[model samples]
Target: MDDTDQIVLSVDGLQVLIDVLTADGYRVIGPTVREKAIVYDDVASVADLPRGWTDEQDGGRYRLVRRDDSALFGFAVGASSWKQFLHRPVVKLWRARRSKNSWQVVPEVPPVERLAFIGVRACELEAIKLQDQVLLEGEHPDSHYQARRDNVFVVAVNCAVAGGTCFCVSMSTGPKAESGYDLALTEISDGEEGTVFVAEAGSGRGRSLLAKLPHRPASAADRQSAKAVSERTAASMGREMRSDDLHELLHRNLDHPHWDAVAQRCLTCGNCTMVCPTCFCTTVEDASDLTGKEASRTRRWDSCFTIDFSYLHGGSVRTSGGARYRQWLTHKLATWFDQFGTSGCVGCGRCITWCPVGIDITAEVEAIRDSEAD
Candidate 1:
């Protein structure tokens, strides 16, 4: 990653740069205000972005309210997640046909498109990394995942505003990105100074794009201002969690009463897993055609919160909703490091922000810790 103080575009110049990228054969997907929420969609022009739009959210609560400024990427994530693009909520796996003597099966591998994801938050980037480890690093990498991930370009944005539920600072995934992006942007603005984007190239591909743009070398003051902004955003987080000794904390607290306490409020709707950037568990299903002459297989995202997620020969290993919820929370906050060498959470706070029952993971952890301290 190269943070060489490059001033690639003024805030207004970003629109022109997007057009150039589109002409250069990149499918640009970015945030646009729709139905009162910032959503990722195909953007042909700068006007497509949610200018003068923003959002307000709390646990089990969301509203598409207005902001004082017309900042496009001023809000955090919404109900939609990056998983919708990568894993796909629903897809056909293969079509099968039966002959007189035998059944013939043809496996399907869906084609992927070249995409340039713009304004990706740091937590979403971390979730992509986690999926890469699960989908690409295994003995058999998914061909579809490989195609999409390998071909896509990333343009990460440092958060200028933290959502009411955001806690990326606690997860150490933001407000300034450290890795996993092709290009990074920090928006700079003031009533008198106007707006500019402090740009940096994170890869060779990013440098090539930077070279084509009309830009100047950034000053030391520019870098300092960017840092200051990121720092402020990080400090303003609505929640915090103690991650040190998390594994031990969860491991020792398996029988803690906090699990049952959380279960009372947890609806187990799996919204947390669905909104999570890194939860990659999925299930495959096979179904026969009406005529029984053909069959199809499908794969869709699944969550441990579901009762069937832990089904065994006899029955579900985790019989209680409380147990299932505890398993997921523990795996993400505690045991994920042992298995993957990284915490499962990137602190996007989607789990907490979107949960129908307003179950907060940070609060849950703190409760467990407080009990242990007592």
Candidate 2:
């Protein structure tokens, strides 16, 4: 909130910000149009952004359409999150080889890359914070995650247009970014002056970067414009998750008939977990050469929806689709609070948009609550 942290950047000034980050040796990953979707990818300049494009999203549907004007950060949350960079899908844990008489082992070292993430939404920022808690501050901290997370910088974008599947307002995580970002940007256009970015520095590094960019001190009007945009986005959210006693509701409804109802429609495709920004389950695989002379262990992303994910000595624990679906919802909304002191869901609504059958979590939670009310 410092006066020095507030600034207004022209639409063209975005390229300067990217240049500064790149000059600082940070690999800038930002939103770009690819395969008809806005995805996070390597960005070099403003030209790489999805200009004049916004996305339409609903249950089990997503499409990019032309916007009324050229707004770089016009789209909502996409399938990919910053998690893909920090918590990699596949990582080699260690490699071992047979020695003359014994065995030699070599631990996998973490990669070295300085990453600067751009266009991170408020909900996505919360998801990253949750991952930090699980992978960095947990009892058994993951060194690989820590290494990648430590060197990364965040550039958060406040939502100006809420997608049809968005529910971050109800989750109290977004529409406007609060913290965890080095720099925060809010794009505002009155149609008369094209587009301008209202930027604020959240960290010392962010302040330094802002100093390097071609920016002017934000006016009182500029601040109000940004606030109005956030308010509009919050008011326009497509869904809402009632969190009052939500944990208890899920816990007591373990046997709720709604579980069976959703299970019948659920495909167990694991798309929800894959698209989720915060789901962090992983499994390890061990492989060796034909002669057994070399062996390597690699860790990869896994999903609770998978039957093999619950495999035990005899067979999978949660064999039924109903059981797996219940476990996922319960863990995500109920027990996760006990473990992480917060709900696992950020209400970004990726699971809803990406689900092939359009299974909506907010709707499911409401059905359970309504049933209890009955």
Relative to the unseen true structure, what is the C-alpha lDDT of residue 333 in candidate 2, on a scale of 0 to 100? 91
Q: Write the per-residue lDDT of candidate 2 for residues 14-100, one digit (tens) a residue.
A: 888888889999999999999999899999989999988999999999999998888888889888888899999999999999999
* Most accurate candidate by TM-score: 2
Q: Per-residue lDDT of 155-268 in model 1, one digit per residue for the tens?
A: 888888888888888788887877899888887764344667788988888878877777767778888888887988888887788888789999999998889888888888
Could you tell me the lDDT of residue 306 within candidate 2? 93
Off by over 4 Å in 2: 190-192
lDDT of each: 0.81, 0.91
Cα RMSD for candidates in order: 1.7, 1.0
